[model samples]
Target: MHVIIFSWEYPPRVVGQLAEYVRLLAAELVKNRVDVHVVTYHDFLTGAVEEPDGVKVFRVANPVRTHVGILTWALTLNQEVERAAASIYYQVGKQVALVDVHDWHFIPAAVTLKNAFGLPFAYSVESLEDHRAPPANTPYSMSIKSIEWLGFYEAQRVCVKSEWMRDEIVRIHAVPKGKITVVKPKANSWIRDILAMYKSMAGGAGKN
Candidate 1:
C-alpha cells in the first residue's frame, strides 16, 4: 500500500517522543513492504529528500514563522501543509490508498489530500483535549482548541494511542465509537538499547 504520512516532527529534529514514534512506525511500515513517504517541516530550513530505513522523508519549509500572532501562526502552518500535500499527491499519482496523519497539526495536510484525491485519511491522535489540563488565557491554547475540532470532524478513522483518548474523543467530540481505533506504540529494541547505552555513559560521566 502506498501511504503518505504527514507529521509535524520526525527524527534528527525531535521535539518529543512523537517524532521518534513516527520514525519507528515508518520504518516498520517499510519492513512490511509498504511504500511510506513522510512530509514534515524542516526546522533547519533545508529542503532535502532522503530515504531512511526504506521510508522516504521529505522536509519542507515552514511558512508559519512570519505570523506574529498565535492564530496566524496556526493558519500559516495549515497553509504550508496544504501546499506540501498538493505536491505529494501530484507526484505520488492517484493509486495512493491512505493518507495517515500523526497528529492534529497535520490534519490540514491529510484533509487536503483526501479532498483533492478522494482518498480515505486516518488520524492518530496522540493527545486529546480532555487528556490535557484546562486551557489558560493564552492565545496559543485557544487557537489549538479551535483548529483541532476540525481535524476530528475530517478524519475517517481516528486512531488513539491510549484508551483514554479513544473514550475522550467519543464522549467529548461525539465521534462514533466505530470510527475510533486504539493502537499502542510498538517499541523498537534497537532504539531502546541505544538509549540504554547513552544513559549508561551519562551516568558514568556524572559520577566523575
Candidate 2:
C-alpha cells in the first residue's frame, strides 16, 4: 500500500515525543512493505529525501516567519504541505492509497486534497485543542477546535492511541464510535493494525 503521512514534526526536528513516535511508525510501515511518504515541517532544512530506512521524507518550511500564534503558522505552512502532497500524487501516477495525517495541524490540506483529488485520508489523533487549552470556548481556541472537528467529520477513519482518547473525541466532536479506532502506539501489532486501517480507507477511496 502507498500512503502519505502528514506531521508537524519528524526526526531532526523534535519538539516532543510525537516526532520520534511518527518516525518509528513510518519506518515500521515501510518494513511491512508499505510505501510511506512523510510531509513535515523543518525551519531551515527543507526539501525531500529518501531515508535509509526506505521511508520518503518531504520537509516544508513555513512561508511566513512571524505569526502571533501557532494557528497562523500552521495555516500558512499547510499550503506548502498541500503542494508537496499534490506533487507526489501526480508523480506517483495518482495511485496513492490514502493519506494518514498525524494530527490536526494539516487537516485543511488533507481536506483540500480529498475534495480535489478523491484521495481519502485518516486522521491520526495525537492531541486535541480542547485538552491543550481547556475551556476551548474562546474565539482563538474555538478556531482550533473547528479544525479538529473538520478532520473528524471529513476523515474516512479516525485513530487514537487509547480508548479514553477515542471516547473524548466522540464526546467532543460527536464522532461515531465505529469511526474511531484505538491503536496503541508501538504495540506488537502496531504496524499490522495501522496497515489494516490504511487498507480499509484505501478500499473506500473516491467514495468520500
The runs of at least 3 residues in candidate 1 whose Cα sits more than 4 Å from the true structure, single-residue gaps closed, are 69-71, 136-139, 186-208
Clashing residue pairs, candidate 1? Answer: none
lDDT of each: 0.67, 0.92
Any runs in candidate 2 off by more than 4 Å, and if so which? Answer: none
Residue-by-residue lDDT tens digits, candidate 1, 61-168: 655567676456545676666666666656766556667787777776667666766766777777754455364335666556655777778776677766788887
TM-scores of the models, in the order given: 0.79, 0.96
Expressed as tens digits, the lDDT of each residue in 1-208 for candidate 2 is 7799999999999988889999999999988998899999999888899999999999999889999998999999999999999989988888898998988899999999999989999999999989988988989999999999999999999999999999999899999999998899858888789888888888888732
